[model samples]
Target: MMNLDAVEQAGEQIWQTRKKMNYTTLGLTVAYTVQMLRDGEIYIPEYQGHIVWSDKKRMRLIESVLLGLPISEFFAVKIDEEKWELLDGVQRLTTLDAFLNNDIQLKNLERLSKCNGFRFSDFSALEQGKFESRGTRVVLLLENLRLETRLDLFMGINGLDKQATL
Candidate 1:
């Protein structure tokens, strides 16, 4: 079991490592769109690919934005200085990805294009404003845990709801 200090140290180290990686899909164009769904990456044909965000979810996000709510959430992940991978909260991260790519249309927002495994990013100017205002957050946890740990974080945040991960 990890003590408080040890856990804190582990987390800090992970962040340091993550920063070192300096990950940003910013300019990287997506050669293919992969859906990080409940099963895994599923390539979607241009015509078939669609944002999974339902009306309710998109509406809630829009309302939160209109209300000036902050929606950044960190996903805790285990770390290995040599080889790092997601240890938890991959679903929310995946969802944010969908939003970033402009997959799900916000109340007034529209769908953009898709990127990577599952990122939608190609949108009408009007839609962009709506979702951008919603403001989603990504939280990454640093700890050397395994799939079990990742599952725990996913369930913890999802609350018994089986969420998708990209």
Candidate 2:
């Protein structure tokens, strides 16, 4: 069986390319989200789909893109309708999306020796100062995988905190 949890090899290059893309993925996702917003797509806030992300986690994800961090933690799944479903790390994705769209400005870091940030928008070079100076990384997985048992998987992915017995 494949170590679905083991970080994939392409993780590094994808992360590098993403940084080279200078928040390109984030930009695209943001634009898509914006269209959703304009289309009046509403996500229930009570779902806490509105969970607030902190500066530290945002920095880690930004750094994950900039530094070629491995794709160790989560699985990326392409849902039937083609939505990019993060099997885990919803909070992380939300944070990255928010920062990229300027719903929040990423905080603290210095310029990347590799790419010029200004040619872009929210990640304009000005924001590069906030990128994690080191230990940044992320890798994209190409596997079209769904858990053998989605209920167990969803509970596993979301955690057991909500399950309780009276």
Candidate 3:
């Protein structure tokens, strides 16, 4: 059992450590996000999970976008002025990228049934534009942070212990 004073001291220490971490939140448009991915601006860490979302799940995500539902914010760590390491939301980001790049065809979209068989190209120009302009929220842990801390945070955020080497 922990002493009351010791517990309070530990809590204060945790709060102070968290205060030292820097981060920011912003809304990035789909077009900008796709461009970043295409241009290789964001880095996916090796320990990140592989894309395993089923076609139905992917379709539902797209359907949510089309229906204006809020998506969970992506978490990344800034590597420098021009690069970032993605920590979370890889599945969502990649799925959106694949869909916009015409690599994914919508199927089993319950809410957007008419778009079930459609690809990005099949959408009307206005609809396509709207989709491209959609904003996804992202949380970025700023640069200058230690790699170990970043990895620890990633593990904490994802609840994984893959023994990442870097």
Candidate 4:
């Protein structure tokens, strides 16, 4: 049988440990984020799942950014001093990655319908500048966080979204 005093002490220790974890919020430009993805500095875990956004959905998100609308924030954990593991915003990041790499073309955009069928390479210089200038907010769990804490945080955040799973 478990000792009651020992269990209470263990629980207190866990609570104190968790209180010490630190996090930081940053606003990163689309250009910088895409560059990091290309360089493989951002880790996309398998649990975040595949890129499932349709062309229309992807296009809409891009249009929102160009229109300076607020997009959802991303959650990531620092893997090291130089690398980050993305916990949320997989779909958003993957869509941007694909679009920037010209692997996917924008289509059926509502606000920017004329941009349909155009790859990032086909964008005018001004359009490219606008796209790159847009920024997204990121909440980073510092490296001091335990792996299990990070995983729990990821699950808790994603579980509330109907589109995400373990």
Candidate 5:
């Protein structure tokens, strides 16, 4: 049988943690976010590891954005008044960076097959403008949040689920 006292204590702890979470939701343009990444204002936590997204995966992300699909919200925690750390969405952010900066050649795309073999620079001005102006939703965790709480949130939200795609 389960220990009732232990269960009660765990429930109380969960309540306390939930009470302490403070966050805000905002939409930022793709160009703004990519610039933030380039300017080093947004940092990817070491726990996220390196970029593991393949070209096909990256291409699909770009295609989804071009198609105006609803992409997942990015989760980040404010490290200080001027800095922020990415807690989740590393793959998506890095993929955007790689594609927007023309670091990778996209191919084998199904929906946007016409974009095959094209880098960011090769896109028409209208297509590039559309991509740059796209809105991306983000969840910002305030700096008051404890590191342990941030990790717990990350694991609970992302570690248990398979990767999300549109």
Candidate 6:
């Protein structure tokens, strides 16, 4: 038979433990986030699954940024004061990385179809500036958070029924 008292004790312990976790939020620019990705300040773990977003989806994300729309927040865990492990938004960041490096070409954009074939390099200075200047919100899970908690949070966020495409 199940031990009801022990189960309640365990639940209480979990609630008490989670009460001590810390987090912070920051609004950072797309250019800054991309720069961090390129510089290795922010990265995905090898175990974090592959990038599955299609090219058209990627273009739509970039289009949202360029058009000043609010993209979803990125969630990351602090590895140190200077480094972060991306828990959410891997696909979005990977798309940005691939596009910025000219590895992927933008295509099939609905409203911005005129620039469909363009890579990051193809954008004019003004267009590039607009793209880079847009802000993306980030939520940082502080270093004090335990690995199990971080993993649970990551899994919970990713396991949602309606996955965030942005």
Tell me the number of clashing residue pairs for each predicted model.
Answer: 23, 10, 0, 0, 0, 0
The regions of model 3 sitting more than 4 angstroms off are: 49-51, 162-166
Residue 85, model 1: lDDT of 45
- Clashing residue pairs, candidate 3? none
Could you give me the TM-score of model 6 versus the true structure?
0.82
> Would you list the C-alpha lDDT of every candidate in the order shown?
0.42, 0.43, 0.84, 0.80, 0.81, 0.81
Top-scoring candidate (lDDT): 3
Candidate 4: how large is its RMSD? Answer: 5.1
In model 4, which regions exceed 4 Å deviation?
1-18, 160-166
- Give residue 132's error in model 6 in angstroms: 0.6
TM-score of each: 0.38, 0.40, 0.90, 0.80, 0.84, 0.82
User: Candidate 5's residue-wise lDDT over 15-92, tens digit each?
Assistant: 997777788998998888888888888888765674377766778898899888867899988888877888888888
User: Model 6, residue 22: what's the lDDT?
Assistant: 73
- The candidate with the higher TM-score, 3 or 6, is 3
lDDT of 1 by residue, 1-166 (tens): 8899999999999999556432322111111111233223321222212235455565554345334566544343425543334333233345545566556554443332131122234445554455454434333344555565555555665554334343
Worst ten in a row by lDDT for model 4: 157-166
Candidate 6, residues 108-150, lDDT tens digits: the string is 8888788888888899989888888788889987874666666
Q: Which candidate leads the pack in TM-score?
A: 3
